[model samples]
Target: MFSYCTDPDTLSGFSWLSCYLTTGKHMAFYRAFGTVLLLLAITAPTALAFGFCGARAARSQVAPLRWFGKIYIAIVRGVPDIAFFLFFVIALDQAFEWLRHQVKCPDWDEPIRQGNDFVVCQIAKMPLGNAPQWVHETYGFFLAILTFAIVFGAFAANILYGAMNTVPHAQMETAEAYGMNRKQAFWRVMVPQMWVYALPGLSNLWMVLIKATPLLFLLGVEDIVYWARELGGSKTARFSDYPHPDWRMWYFLALLVFYLGFTKVSEVVLDRLMTRLTRGQATMGGEAQRKAAA
Candidate 1:
């Protein structure tokens, strides 16, 4: 917004473009890019934590825990991720509201599921109906995060399970022979050793997670994709100050470049992490590192 921006009809070329890009809506659009990054930053660690727990459950001595873990991993992998993303957001939202309804409205006679509608008490409405706009947005984002974690956690569990198995049986046996308990063996020998094997699968999962960020729009989160579509659509004089032709193609191109750059940076970082993890291990990479050092 400069004085020239006051007369858009006369402004053209780079001047018009500069004024257009500096609009308040465009600022929001730019912030949405940061939201995407925030989602990834939050979801990655949360999903990994879920995966670690699921993987541990799958390997648990208790039969029921193992069965539950196995079922979670299997069912999620069997379904399309988009399907899960759609289903889980609704299901989880309802589950939370239902629990809240029970606690907050104990005397309510109406069933939560009256035919197809998921009815809940006013108190149980997510964001409480009276909450601020930011609260609603935050709740949607939280749901998206949960959905992402649930879906990707299963894949991570599978990867970690295989990695755990790849840890040498001899290593565990030696740990036990040294009077280490099963937990100790797992913590000291198996867990650390499995990282080298798991890194490749986990790295791929990270890339998948990055690409899947676009699905945040489906979850009702104001993610970058949502902003891109909203801002890139053809605007009219009646609706916007900066009306233009269809620009979705260019917006999507920007998203593509952003993701490519993100993935490239992740690859570089993960490669370095893998190199660090492989050191002093008995794997091929570790052996190679040792030889090179020698």
Candidate 2:
């Protein structure tokens, strides 16, 4: 960006490095970091909501709802996660386009799948072919978020279901004795107390979620991994400025450090949160906290 950066060929040492890092593509690389954070921000709560509903269904008194929940958890857990990621992105995309095709081109007489190609009318194309580049990117990111949520939600549901059961049976009994209905007891007594049990599992899930962010590359989102591979590859004289040898190892090393730092910060925060949530509860951690305060 500097005036002197006009001649990168003459630039050397830190000057060349500075000009190289400040290029437009590097700016995009920096923005991709925020995209990773954005994915985490959107996915975490959505996954939790999905998990909550799944857990509630699993615990439902109705037979069908309970079975549905059990099937969801079992099916997701049975398959490798990468398989789901690959399958769901394409599946969800086609499902959306199919709905659009049905709505927009109701009279069209063509099968959506002709051999290996998934063809829909131009209007049914996701984000439309004429749409801005950002629209395409945003659509891809949204699909990635949905994939992450669906996969993580099943695991979170299993954790939450177990946590709900770990809540003492007598607590519900006391709530019922006080004339509260099942739903009231569940909300006012069981749900409130289950977090202490669930925190450890949820914390572990959070770390897994963090590690899984790299999978965004597989879904075609321009995530850090994609940018790392792009920016770290060897550049010849035929290319524009900022030529460099293959530095993917160093780029990946930076990613490793970033993830390690993120996990370390998360661990510290989760520990404090666990301590806070556990305090005054009728659990071992609560007992220890009480003793320490005394």
1-294: candidate 2 lDDT, tens digit per residue: 788899899999998999998999889888999999999999999999889999999999999999999988787856789999999999999999999999999998988889989999999999799999989988999999999999999999999999999999999899999999998999999999998899999999999999999999999999899999999999976796877889989989999999999999999999999999988888898999999999
The Cα error of candidate 2 at residue 261, in Å, is: 0.9
Q: Per-prediction count of colliding residue pairs?
A: 0, 0
Q: What number of backbone clashes does candidate 1 have, counting pairs of residues 3 or more apart or in separate chains?
A: 0
- Itemize residue pairs with steric clashes in candidate 2: none
Candidate 1 lDDT: 0.90
Q: Best-fitting candidate, measured by lDDT?
A: 2
lDDT of 2: 0.93
| Clash count in backbone of candidate 2 | 0
Error of 2 at 245 (Å): 1.1
